[model samples]
Structures are given as C-alpha cells and as structure tokens.
Target: MPRVGLFITCVNDALFPETPKAVVTILERLGYDVDFPAAQTCCGQMHANSGYKKDAAKLARNFEAVFDPYDAIVTPSGSCAAMARDQCPHLTGSTIGRRVYELSEFLLDVAGVEDVGARFPHTVTYHPTCHGTRALGLGDKPIRLLRAVAGIELIDLPAAEQCCGFGGTFALKNSEVSSAMLADKCRHATDTGAEYLAAADNSCLTHIGGGISRLGRTPGAAKAPRPVHYAEILASTA
Candidate 1:
C-alpha cells in the first residue's frame, strides 16, 4: 500500500466536505493509507483559472511542498487535479505534478482495479465535466466504475459530453450563457428519469442540480433528478 494524500479542493472543502469524507471511506476500504495534510491550501487553481498567475504560482509552490512527500496525491475534483498535474510543473517542477491524479484515474489506472465492491440501488445518469472530459481525458473510466457497482442502473446522459456550464469563474463571468447551457444539460438529465444525476466534479453537480430544481418553476414543479457526487454513490454499499 502506497502512502496517499487527499487534496480536498477549496470548493469541496467549503461546500461539499462529504466528498472528501467519501473518498477516504472508499480508499480505506481498499486498504489504502490516506493522509490529509493540514498545511494543504487551494491548488491555486481558482487564482490561475481566474487569470491571477502570480497568486497561482505562489499557491502552486505551496502545493508541491505539502504534497511532494507523499507517494500519491488524489483529488475528487478533476479540475483541481488538472491544476496540480498540468499547471504546477511550470510553476514549480515535475516533482509533485506527476504524482497527482483525478479520483477515477487513480482507481482504474494506478490502483489497477475497476470494482471496489460498492453497491447502490438507484438509477443514475452521469455528466462528465470539462476538465475530466477534456483535460483529464477520463473517458469511460467513471462509467466503467459506475457499471460495476452492484445494483446501480446507469443511464446515458443525452449530450453527455456537453458542458454543464460551471467552469468555476466562468459561471460568474457569463451568467446568462452559463444558465442557458445548464438548461440543456438539466433537461437531458431529467429526461432520463433517473433518481440522481452524478458527476466527477461537485462544481458541475452544484450547477446542474440547481438547474434541475429551479428551471421552469410553476405553482408546483415536478420532481427533478437529484444531484450527487458519483464518488458518494461509489462509496455506498446499499
């Protein structure tokens, strides 16, 4: 068992702490020794992605210092993982950059295992975010794991590769355009009649989940698919 550190990104740490918790549960079940470095800060992704190169560089240096000691750095957010693997090397070096991995990529490629003995009896439709889809190129890894879950009914999301309109600050900078894109993704998710809509990135889940509930409100809106992190689903046994 290699020493592993969990990089609970700013969004997951602040808004969706349960995501990191679930990551711990799944890894522990697989006999992994997971560490959460207290000194760990945001991977400077928010700063870099928002065009603050100086700030991003500073935080990127800190990221290498805190995580370099570990054998592996795993994160639930594909976007955050991308920042570490794709951006940090230019700021720092290849030291820690080569060690970072998006959750599913680590599970399927590094760990060399697909089924984690998870069981969840619910219909689920997955939305692959831009980073996991384009940056990470995590095609079908998430879907492969979902299919292996004991009782999961995984359905295909229409326009599955389309963006969920939450590109971190992109949502804030282009609210109207973001909302329009979200509407299409949510419509496709709801049309599947799945109980929950899941994604590798919680930020995307937050956006599309909100749209499912808030789009086209009337006196009484119909039931919409719930938004949940696929990791949480993968961590389940019932």
Candidate 2:
C-alpha cells in the first residue's frame, strides 16, 4: 500500500473537523496508510485569492515541505486541492503539486475504488463547487460516489455548475452579489426536495447552508436542506 498524507484544509480543521475524520475512515477501509503531518498549515488559498502573493507563497512553500515526503497528498476540500494543484506549482516550483488530489479524485482516480461501502437513506442534491468543477474538473465523481451509496436518492441540482458565490475573499469583497448567488443556490437546493445538499467543499456548503437556515426561519418557508460533505456521506454505514 502507498503512503498517503491527509492534507486536512484549515477550514475543515477549524470548522468542520468531521470532514477529515470521515476521510480517514473511508481511506483506511480502502487499505491505504494515512498520515497526518502535524506541521501542516493553511494551503494559503485565502491569501492567494485575496492577492497576498508573498504570504501565499510562503504558506505554499510550507505546504510543499510538509507533504513532500509522502507518496501522495490527499485533501477533502476541493478548493485547497485546487490551490495546491493550480497555484502551488507557480509559487514553489515543486512537482509535489501534481501528487495532491481532492478526496473524490483520490478515491476514484488514485485508489481505483468506487464503492466505499456506505449507506445513507435520504434524498440528496449535490452542488459542484467552482474550484472542483472548473479548476479540478471533478465532474460526476462525487455524484457517482453518492449514487453508489445504498438507499440514496440522488436528485439533479438545477444550475449545478453555477457558482455558490463563496469564492473565498469574493464573498467578503462582494457581499451583495455573493448573497444573491447564495440565495439562488439555496433555492435550487430546496427546490430539489432533497433532505441534504451535498458538495465537496465545506466553504461553499457553509455559505449555502447559512442561506438554508435563514430561509427556514421565514414565515411559511419550506424546510431547509441540510448541508453535508461528500466524505461524511461516503463514510456512513447502513
């Protein structure tokens, strides 16, 4: 078995720790040696996207140094994976970027394993994040994995390729536009009548999920769709 390093993104580390736990559960079941490098820190995605190139470069170097020894570096966040794969090479000039993969990419493309032996009895609508869809081109991998789960009703999310408006600093800089985009995404998610709204990136889920909660509080509003990470669902059991 190859040695794999789990690059738990800073967002998941601080806000959604369960995402990394689920990643480990599924990877271990697939028969891979997973290691967490304690020295690992933020992939500098926020800094990079916010135009702090110098700081981003420093963090990118730190990321390369920590995971360079591993045979493969896997992360559950597509945004972080995009940063490593797309931005790190330009910053650090290291080939380690090529070895980094998002969770779904690692499981489907690297491990060559599809059925993760999970079961979730609920209607699900998957939202494809911009970094995952445009940057990483992670088309259908997450959905295919969800479909393989027992007792899951995978519904199509309208405008599935549209941005959830949680583009890191984009949300902070353009709050109005971001809010509008998030509202549209939340509407689509609720329209699907799915109990859960799934996505590969928690950052996007955080934005959409917040909108869902706000909508639920409105008078005569429909039940909000709960945001769920793909890794968590894949780690579930019947």
Hey, what RMSD does candidate 1 come out at?
Answer: 1.3
On residues 14-102, what C-alpha lDDT tens digit does candidate 1 reach at each position? 99999999999999999899999999988898898888989999999988889888988999998998888788777766658678888
Model 1 / residue 21 / CA error / Å: 0.9
Give candidate 2's whole-model lDDT. Answer: 0.91
lDDT (Cα, 0-100) at 105 in candidate 2: 91
The segments of candidate 2 whose C-alpha lies over 4 angstroms from its true place after superposition are: none
lDDT of 2 by residue, 161-219 (tens): 99999898889999999999999999999999999999999999999988999999999
Error of 1 at 220 (Å): 5.7
Model 2 residue 21 CA deviation in Å: 0.3
